[model samples]
Target: MRQWLFALGGLLVWTAHFFAVYIAASLFPGEPLASWLTLGLTLVALVVVGWLGLGAWRVWEARGEDELRPWLGGIALMGAALSAIAILYAGLTAVFF
Candidate 1:
């Protein structure tokens, strides 16, 4: 059950990320971002997603352990932090770039 829950959350995160990129590209089709800046943003997004995958892996590995709270809490905190950072980056990019 815990495994399934983590799997579902990961899938949802992936789907959201896909749509987010689509929406961003659509909205900012003609922005003046440097090629390197664009590449860097892409890399940052990948790192955020990678962190999510790591969190999911951690939860899955600790499923049978008694310390599930720490795993879940850390994942939640990381996810929130990633999301906040991404959103701030996007807003700043659109506003100033």
Candidate 2:
């Protein structure tokens, strides 16, 4: 439902961050500054998504099975996990490529 929007906020941020890094890497290949820039951006994105995910989990716990909250929390946590993995993969690729 509408609550899912809140759940997906972290995911949305992550998608944007992913593409930003992708384009930056493409546009500035082999540049030391580009690597550093992508790394910094990736770190910041992880922190933000992680915080949002934690907040959703805490709220869900406090709500105690309330309608919609659990779904929101579950999805948020999943999104956070996905984002972290995606970011790490992207980061390693950025580093090694």
Candidate 3:
């Protein structure tokens, strides 16, 4: 359970941020509040993803002779990178459009 959570943490955060931004946009329509909310959410998401990526990187580096640990860390790191890109794109689109 914990391992799965660690692996999917970045993706989960991205999903949550995506939904939150969508809801905020729907609620606020053309209001500036929606943009503000999106900006805040994007920053938070980035920070969280970055933290997760760092942890994953540490695991990857410290894997030593272990094979599975490196794989897990690599997957998590990739997920975090992808999530960051998605979060940024979504945030920009939501705020601008």
Which candidate has the highest TM-score of all?
3
Task: List model 3 lDDT by residue over 1-97, tens digit each.
Answer: 8989999999999999999999999999899999999999999999999999999999888847778899999999999999999999999888777
Candidate 1 lDDT score at position 79? 59
TM-score of 1: 0.39
* Candidate 3, residue 92: lDDT: 86
The estimated TM-scores of all candidates read 0.39, 0.84, 0.95
Model 2, 32-85: lDDT tens digits are: 878987988888888888888788778667666467777777778888778788
1 against 2, candidate with superior TM-score: 2
Quick one: ranking by TM-score, best first?
Answer: 3, 2, 1
- Model 2, residue 83: what's the lDDT? 79
Candidate 1, 1-97: lDDT as tens digits: 7644544453445455545655666666766543334445555555655666677556546655568655664665455456545644554454356
TM-score of 2: 0.84
Which should have the higher lDDT, number 1 or number 3?
A: 3
